[model samples]
Target: MDGTVVTDRTAETVGADGTAGRDALNAAAAASAAEGSRSEALRTLSRVFGYDTFRGEQQAVIDHVVDGGDAVVLMPTGGGKSLCYQIPALVRPGTGVVVSPLIALMQDQVDALRALGVRAGFINSTQDFEERRLVEAEFVAGELDILYLAPERLRMQGTLDLLSRGTVSVFAIDEAHCVAQWGHDFRPDYLALAVLGERWPDVPRIALTATATPATHREITERLGLPEARHFEASFDRPNIQYRIVGKDDPKKQLLRFLREEHEGDAGIVYCLSRNSVEKTAEFLERNGVPAVPYHAGLDGGTRARHQSRFLREEGLVVVATIAFGMGIDKPDVRFVAHLDLPKSVEGYYQETGRAGRDGLPSTAWMAYGLQDVVQQRKLIQSGEGDEAFRRRAASHLDAMLALCETVQCRRAQLLAYFGQEASGQKCGNCDTCLTAPETWDGTVAAQKVLSTVVRLQRERGQKFGTGQIVDILLGRKTAKVIQFDHDQLSVFGIGDDLSEAEWRGVVRQLLAQGLASVEGEYGTLVLTDASATVLGREREVLMRKEPKRPAGRPKSERTAKGERKQAVDLPEEALPVFEALRAWRADQSREQGVPAYVIFHDATLREIALSLPADLTQLAQLPGLGEKKLANYGEAVLKVLADHGRLEAGTALEDDSSSSGAESPSGD
Candidate 1:
């Protein structure tokens, strides 16, 4: 903001002798200023954003981007991806241009930055012409620190010309996975973003995403023309979210039980498969005394915005939504994300469930999946109006999702392996499969019988049968179709008579997952693949675990999420009310200030304040989130809240105060 360092394009030229003398002095001053600004990035991180240090992969990302090098960042949903670009945007000179995908997210990002006293603005269709001109004037005058724009606006010539006139510092492309054709969140506008490399060849460009596979990663770099950019990949694993999949039987009742018993009065998201389901589920929850709202493409924009606003500001608001929501939600305390229907792919499931437990607390990724999901997904993948390659890819992704759902090994390990990271031996004790440790049975004989039946049926009838008919024949059930086909006389028909329907289903699902068998055609006809030969010939053995069944309307007895929980802030029982009061204060302030509550202070910080009960503004400022400006602004109120709570706990045990211990909470495993 100093005027001496400001560059002028039309200034008059000076004499060589005078210029030489001035240039030396200017170079010295610039060197000193650069060093100061480099350090200022760290200072501002604490003073403005209220963080004492950079998180994992954040400081390195900031250093790389601040040094004017391009970077490709792949971090988890709550992994502090914003700070990687934000810190550098502040440390580097000129206004930071961000290409955001959604208008709703643009508003939240601007509000959050403004809350931290950063001069941030956004340009999008939501703004009128006059508003756009005002932001443009401020941007051209270099009064803005960060200006977010929709991808379409960024590709416009007028916007491009405007950027050419100013010292544009950095270009940050959020949700860079949108450029990949095979990704679920693909957007055509992102394809135009490759021009950023050509237009501003010297400006450092950073592409960031919370969801990406190895294939998607390659596509993003190629599309964005960032093949040579520095790369920083934080672990894609969200360990705070405990993965649990239950068989769907009376889903509405099961969902109610989960809410009433485990997560009563906690905020969460219920993802449904259709708009009707979203609306119906919202109504169902409301009828059962749980406050709920619906969100989808069918709802009016005004209604959607209101619902989102309430979900962000209010506590215990359940949003039953289709896949239309939760892409860029900034709410940090979502305790759970429940899937009423199976997601289309593993990437979508991972990204959606990750919206929960962003604060490094124990959260849940629960799903009620069943055979119907597999049928519907298979139909969609097989009969969709796409090319052969696209359909095959869809089938592949669906198969992978099914594998994760039915995997007997660690769910986290299976998921990480899909993204090319191996973790076979590193067990995550949080997931349901890992927690229960189900018993396995030698399924090699069952696999051989099933494969032989498929081969016999194909050889005799010149076609295979669906899973239902195949199961009927295997169980020796003399159904009408079985008798008509004379399948009862086959050698392998009665060989599987000992297994139950559920057990046979498990074996079949495992066969499909392990690539020993495949399903073909619209009827889901069972067909044998190459791997079936090894199993049929006794060269490779097969083992499978029976999938556990869930009670229709009862909650699990484990009290791990909220009760018997392990969170970053461990306050004593006496300090619980004070923590709640601090949260109430934060919510009220967030409403009045029109920003997300975490923008003021995270729940972890409030918990610390309640436990330690800081006596004055000075003690409060010593906390990680209470920086200089915030100390001057809300420090007194925080102190009052803490002082009142301190008196309430004055007779409590004389525990050591640790709200300002200056040690960071360790990240999840």
Candidate 2:
């Protein structure tokens, strides 16, 4: 949700908030009934879906859709959004048509749904015409409860004709934010789905998006022809995902160090901006003792799918990929996500980082960014074909992302603030900035000089020029660009010599971020927006964080003394004693099984079995980390230890029943 829509589009608020309006009265009545109906719904939800309780606005949104109404749902990444619509589709009378963006996701989702005994099917580009016909027949006869289609297919003539004959219950658009061009992923095909109302007016519609800014929410409702949709906004807080952004310098080394120190044998993904980078990084990591695989658009479909399957099924394997990967992937145990390069916008940044900690365990979001990333992003946007209006909005978004990179404030606070949410924390103490304090300097005069230079340039040149050019003019360096442009004669010239070029760049980046300046893609110019004039007119104060010197060694621990992010062996302290005893017994059992010590019992399941201290096999399966295979194989031995010891606590020990003399094993065992 760390995104916004700052475009020329008009946003309309549909229903009145007062007491007596028809829409409001209807919405209130629906809300009242939802509280009472949850119990009945729960019986059906559990019997059909195997889920007991709703997660984060799921029930409210589902109720809104179920009772013949329109709604726009904004939920976080792992907030169980699919269930909000899926449950209602199951309860509805006719087939529910879901418009999604990805074909692979549709297949996986439908497979999972069918596994639950729901009548689900999908039509996408991957299917042949005959295959498509079979699916269409099933959908037309109401044999399929939920039908998934891409936005493009939803608008196709053949598909529309088929839908016209079938009894459509509701229309749900997944990833609804793609309807707006201002959003990160703007698909032209998505804009065509707005005519669903014109095609079928009576069907209740639901627009679902994982991350939407205020503007995006407005755009989605307006474009999708849902002017009177009820709104359900889930909180954007993901407390489990620890966020950290490091300044660019030896990024590869920092990544290696972080991986070695924290994620020695955990599953994770390292994202890069290019295919070559992905392959190179993956190979380097493998050489350094971590088993890793590279995935990108450059690989053939078969190879890519095979590698992805391996990564998902195996533990402790890292996948280095480009933006092409990790979309809608349901692998929940990804321990960390590392970005080798900075993203173009905060929305893109948030979406990428949100992939970590999906299982609600402790995880890290690490990024390495620099000024070069800013320049490249500006060049890309400038080169894109669009009106000046589009360029300005894109530039503003990029500046906001850059500001996030350079801020001394809490990283989480700045991130949440961009999406118009107030993060109630003075210090997150998880990010690099929060872990180590930065040097702050009063750059009021320097800020004024930079603004004055922009004004002297008549605000014509775009904001893409580096602070070096402006600082040169201010310090009277007489650089060629400044001399040719006659910027050296300005009164602001020679006023910023107290600041170095790197320091000045930081200020310019912050100014752009605060909306004081705008970056122009054409002619690679930098201009000031209306926000900049206010700063120059003394209405806003300018504060900047000086770039901290790269620490000679590792910075002090960002976590607290208790190891806030310390990756322990996933064992409870109360059962550690039993774990030690089992590990020793397993070490001796390895000789009998003719296998390695870990082959007999992994540290992960041993920890779980020990924590449960299961006196019987039935109770052992209920423990946190034990699986069917583990429970079947190690059930008896693990239960024997707990029964013999009768739940030994962390520091206590039990007599060695396996040893004839009943002696305790040494600490190493």
> Whose lDDT is greatest here?
1
Candidate 2 lDDT tens digits, 375-466: 56777777887999998898878878887887778888888887788877888766666667666777666777788887776644432455
Candidate 1 local lDDT, 1-669, one digit each (tens): 344543331123335566744675576566666667667878988888767788889888887788789999999998999888888888888999999887887888887787678899999899999999999999999999999988998668998988887778899999999999899898899999999999889899999998889999999999999978998998888888888887777899989988876777888999999999999999999999999999999999999999998898787799999989998898888988999998989889988998998887778888997765776677677778899999988988888898898777899998888877776366888788777776688899999888888998888768678888878888999999999988888887777878888778778877876778877677777788888899988999898866665463223554535453323245777677888889888888988887778878877778778777788776777677676767787888888876776675764433333422323433321
Model 2 pairs in collision: 462-525, 462-526, 462-527, 463-525, 463-526, 463-527, 464-525, 474-494, 475-494
lDDT of each: 0.83, 0.73
Q: Which candidate is the best by TM-score?
A: 1
For each of the candidates, the C-alpha root-mean-square deviation to the true structure, in angstroms, is 8.6, 10.9
Where is model 1 more than 4 Å wrong at Cα? 1-35, 422-425, 449-465, 476-497, 520-539, 549-558, 561-569, 646-669
- lDDT score, candidate 2: 0.73
